[model samples]
Target chain A: MSSALHTVSATDTLAGRVLHDTGVAVAECYQCGKCSAGCPLADEMDITPSQILRMLQLEMPELDDEVLRSHTIWLCLTCEMCYARCPKEIDLPKVMDSLRAESLRRKVAHPKARDIIAFHKSFLDSIRTCGRLYEILLIVAYKVRTRHLLQDLLMAPKLFVRGKLNPIPELIRGRSHMARIFQRAQRKDG
Target chain B: MTMKMGFYPGCSLKGSSREFNESLCAVMDKLGVELEEVPDWNCCGATAAHNLNHALSLSLPARILALAEGAGMQEIAVPCSACYSRLVMTRHELQENEALKAEIADIIEMDLALNAVPINVIQALDRALEGASLESLVVAPLAYKVACYYGCLMVRPPKVLRFDQPEDPMTMDRMMERVGAEPIDWAFKVECCGAGFSVSRTDLVAKLCKPIVTDAVKRGAEALIVACPMCQSNLDMRRCAIKGMSEAEAHIPVLYITQAIGLALGIDRKDLGLQRHLVKVALPRRAVVGA
Candidate 1:
């Protein structure tokens, strides 16, 4: 959700190495359907989490529209039950994350998925300046972006009055450390 | 010197789960553990973000880890189950491949020192619980039958997050014992709670929650203990929706980690962050910490 104002040209090859990065041996996934069977969101999908990973293994470039736009990506709760169940220990969520990122790049998003996206953008915006999320700013941005500006308005006033809504966000004392942290993480990997 | 792990509390604790953080700080300090919240950390992209964008998903948690390594803190403790899982997975991925680390570095413009530190909430809890006996530190033990709920986020999608054994994680149960509560052995430990649907799809949440709650009650748990805020909120707030589906009265209270700790520490009800809760506790008025 941190805006890639820092976009690069073919800079993120880590997407490939993420297979190794996750400690999940993707090669261990021998087309076994255990992941498909264990996935609560699998039956409702045309491309199961396992299939997506299989495509990754086979190096398939083009993904189906149903798989890209459906709430299945959003439906994955990241509980990691499937990873433990996988005889190969493939992290389905990691592969799903790659698929989700691809969907974002293609601008193929679910309807309600936009509202959630708004929250993501809002969240990063808060951290970019200060080092953490600002609850008030986040909710305000989420409501405004979704055009449901008044959904939690009443609750906001009550929470603010309770000293719970701190106006000043707890950002890094000096952002030099913050910027370096971002720069360093983008560089470190599997 | 004791170990000092970097902490990233995330937005929920800064807002709704503040009391949980407060109690965590208290109990940890009393136990001689020092937790330093990561300086200027961001959201771990939560459940919704990663689903929308995978690269960005790793990017979110990796960003926080990057800061901890900068501060010379090798390990990071994330309290929220979802954040812990994502951060841990991202850390694992970053460490396995040099190319990926270089790529993420290119995206965020920083070098991520991809060491294999555990980015887990329970792992952190396990470390925190070390050298301390659960039975010895109780002023107010939660003696009720408690169903330790994992609620999907803590365990799922084998590839990205392997926080526990997946099918049957016992971290929560162990913590419950330290708090003097009887933990229930149940099948739904790794089940889904229709996450994020509490706002988008209430019916789905109710449908998923009813069974989990019914099963917990049937197993004799007076309340549910959870590590994730979203799960706690959904399971607690959607009580009416879940209750409407059931034939019998649903009377179990859903509690967060710190709240349970607060009860065991005998903190007042108001201080325990109970007011914001949706499900009412069965305990008497005085026993509600920080009420």
Candidate 2:
């Protein structure tokens, strides 16, 4: 059970905005810790998935970005174990994703999991350029950004010898169409 | 039923997991189906797009589905579990929310077709060979004990996937049984192997994948079978790299379901891309009956 901190009010739009965008009602969660119990990476999170929802239930602030900056949001595997075990059928993964989107959009500080953000940015950049992910190029770019050049050095030669790494990325004919979609999505979001 | 399916190999299949693509093609050929490649398919946006922008994630997969429908494909088979999850989730979201669908339609510059249902390789093969003769195709019975690792993306978010039992999925188990391999009951079948974090958080991935690899081996599983390239990469390629596990202790061979099937069909190991694996693959010896 969560300690009493604040009371829920009608004007709290964080819960409403979440419900509007993702259809997940934060008020429905009873802080059973069922989600935390089932979460595989719960041990690594600064705040458990259940606790994150509890914050919204209390309506801490509309744009506090405190929960968004928590390592819990980035550490989530999006494996949906918590989502599967939720009695309220609350999609924790979706909620976490929404928080991550908000975190990125607001340019809030992601204290932990900076490597994940770098990898994600590199991955999307790869797709945006080639219209498809080029693993070899994506890895190099990620390595450069994260300064993890030495982690998987041993596996590179093996991957290449096995015909896994290609020198050039295959460009899809739908590249321009995909670029258009990216542009529209950005404009709409902005 | 001479079923033809449009195949969306995703980027992984084309890049790192070429063996998955090769084995799938060989197995499907034996199962009697033509896997027409979806032409001009873009990335499925995977975990990256969804976290940054909601519409880009849905629109990316929607574009691929729309292309499959345009190619006259009623069913699309995706071998990568991440891609499968993205595609199915996109459809689920679009179907449930009409406003989102309309917005996505405008962004992609096309109508979002709720049709062209996506199926993973396991389901696709099971459906194709449902009434066909499977015993005759088995030249090599995969007699060794194996663990079918579904990981999270394949079966989780069960409401949207609607493909198998979330906690205890038996599609791979049943399929492996049909092919003469004993599928072991393991705890991490639907567990997460730290997907997408493989590159970003190697230590975290190693930590997560350690138990999965150790438990399967501890249970006497000769090989840990997987459907997702990420799982295979994490478990197989990064087996020795895991923080806690030693080289000898964590040396179980991780295989794609298609490669395992190709072996049972007695397809040459070379054709199945067995040699591509990092942990040297060694199949158990067959017991001769008339010795």
Candidate 3:
């Protein structure tokens, strides 16, 4: 199949609807391959960072390739070295970011994606309500999401006994602001 | 005039490494900088999701960036190297990847200010150290030979990062000396130590860690001062396995900059998250005053 540039739409929340409205210029990428050379996890990437930037410059998606599969999408660490190193400054991590979100919205997300999403969701949920990340909630949700409850369970007793964890969360005063922000931000996207 | 910082310690300093937080506060206080912790902060995902799924990881940090923008702070100081990397990297992506930004806005149901700047501890420290002549910034010299460990998250794949050389970064080392500390020049500073995978996959760490520790010790670092919590925890906790495969005992202490700051500030040992450490730590005799 040939790569075709799709027109960005109002529903186009990810590709070109930058909040600032000016959008990032992908043409800035110079194909330095430094993004490729510096990627620690490039071995697992479908196309290297340099290739990904080049594909973006050409307005083509690097979604195909069996071994390079969606698995490569997960392999990008969002380290920003590629962007910092790209002579053209192609925003390689954002491309990965777009592809990764697309993967989940399309429901082809790796099984592990849900677990990661859940951990983050619960992390933010704890913050949205409490106005700060509830450490206990964060760890519990992470362990629960990853299905590795026992991994950090052993540390809870020590943390609890040592007064490291506030069993009761520290609820902030301007708590309503947090919820309101979440509500409005969520609605804006909707 | 006091300079206010939007301090984002990520998950580690709040949960596991309290001392690092305490030390950082004390040290920064001496520098006349006050870190106002963001009222509401979320996990930056660190090196985990970036390795697992790109979009999920970017949005995870982007959402927090969105929240920070909602909080009204434009420049935020990130203490964790991993969190800093994720936040800055996500900022770069959201700015340059419009299509990706649109997709994320759709998925997260929010508009993240891609312009929200993420500054690392090195940058933050540099900011805090601003105005004061580097000569006058030295409170107590961390004269001990310290291995400045940046790990893979700090510098790699350069498109989004621009502070220093990936293979050999000197920003942290140069900063260390400004604070009266000796920074050991060592290879493997940017090597990966299996980070979060240290649990799901132990062998990966053993192989990665062996070289990292060996290189640090071989270079005569009295200890390693790390900007990344994952690196500090991994390098410290996995010492047994690393040493099991080695011919000599590995007693090097891995200290978070926060912990080192606590020590330099004459804070109590109990305040530095020292007891939480698996490996035994030997604080300098001068720092023993607080305990």
Candidate 4:
């Protein structure tokens, strides 16, 4: 029970890691709730944007874990609404990005985030192979990963009829260069 | 003599929102601007890269900027607002941190002079017009009520983008007015349209787009004018998903800013890709004399 009362230093917390990764000090947020007030998806999020910051501010291991596992990080559209309206100018989206990365690394991303993660992975994989986004390939891969094959099936033919969905992707000549960039970026991330 | 400008039509332009590219090209061609495509550009990584790996996001856009710089282009026009935001954010990040810029340069294997700046569609068109009013070039003015939806990426993080008023941006509205269209003041102008989740989280996208579409219609806007591909697609492509919207409300067409301008310039409907939209785009036509 005494362990629950033990104070965790700011530098030894998830907020510290966020600060180190993004240079956005979560401690600067004074819980004005302005971020939550402006967040477009606040109603849908399991944890509001400002609450995520408050969790970080708390600097407890349990709270830190909660922040990492919360669906708010995945739900963020990176629209910068919170950052724009935040009186502290905390750049909450940047912090969310860091939290998302950490969440994936720790394998504790909310289970509901599966589809979103699948879409992102598929999107990146398309770029990795073709240098540009191959929408057809991305959709196929996403459907395969999410097992939502029937989903959006009706819209595909419509897009194709509109000349929006091309059968063959336009490949850039600098394929090898793009591969090299991806490899180096992965290495840097590791 | 037509002015040559560097053009980076990001992935969405080539795929999901080809109409945006078509209309943009048609309008620019009429405006005496020749779009020079950047040689062998790759994806800017968009939301995925930044969400997963920060270095990759910076490296991808840095590579495009480097290619534009190598081509001796002073600035490149990015029509997609998402790509524009990524490129501009990369520039701002690199400018702020020399070490990160060097790291990104090493990753992309380029000198990264960062000379080639990115201009969004509005900025590009504004520059192409060269201080002349759009009314001067209009052959068929788009005389209809419109809600200019700036969406999220184009105007947010105001300190970095520095292009318009973050909350109540009127640049697009002013442009629409110049083209003889009535731009209405409405909420949800700079709101998010649940971008990047169109494929994965359709429910969320529908819920987010509902307010934007409803507000525009409630304000009696004939069409929702947008500069971003994601915004247009979310509002137009996902209109059917927005539950409880009346049949008439669901039919409100979302038009790309370039499409509206192309119509005012008297560019052919097919050339502007007007037939490509899910919702039929039939603006109330009023007679106007070409200047």
Best by DockQ: 4
In order of appearance, the predictions have TM-scores of 0.78, 0.95, 0.70, 0.96
What are the per-residue Cα lDDT tens digits for candidate 4 across A44-163?
A: 999999889888887799999999899989999999998988887889999989899889888999999999999999999999999999999999999899999899889989999999
Interface RMSD for each candidate model?
Answer: 4.6, 0.9, 5.4, 0.7
Say which candidate scores most in TM-score: 4
- Tens-place lDDT per residue, model 2, B34-139, is 8998889999999898877787888899999888888888889999999999999998889898988999999998866788889998888876687886766887
Ranking by TM-score: 4, 2, 1, 3
Give fnat for candidates 1, 2 and onward, in order: 0.41, 0.78, 0.21, 0.84
Q: Write the per-residue lDDT of candidate 3 for residues B123-228, one digit (tens) a residue.
A: 8877887777654544555667788888866775553567788768888788666656779888777767766554544445566678788887788888788888
Per-residue lDDT of candidate 1, residues B18-41 (tens digit): 755776676666666788877656
Alpha carbon lDDT of each predicted model: 0.66, 0.84, 0.64, 0.90
Model 1, C-alpha of B110: deviation from truth (Å): 4.0
Write candidate 1's Cα lDDT for A17-107 as tens digits: 4443344334456787887787765765556777755554543334445556766776665556576677765667666665566567668
Q: What's the lDDT of the predicted structure labeled candidate 4?
A: 0.90
Worst 10 residues of 3 chain A by lDDT: A59-68
Using lDDT as the measure, what is the rank order of every candidate, best first?
4, 2, 1, 3
Give the chain B TM-score for each candidate. Answer: 0.88, 0.95, 0.88, 0.97
Q: Grade the docking of candidate 4.
A: medium
Of 1 and 2, the candidate ranking higher by TM-score: 2
Q: How many clashing residue pairs, candidate 1?
A: 51
> Candidate 1 DockQ category?
acceptable
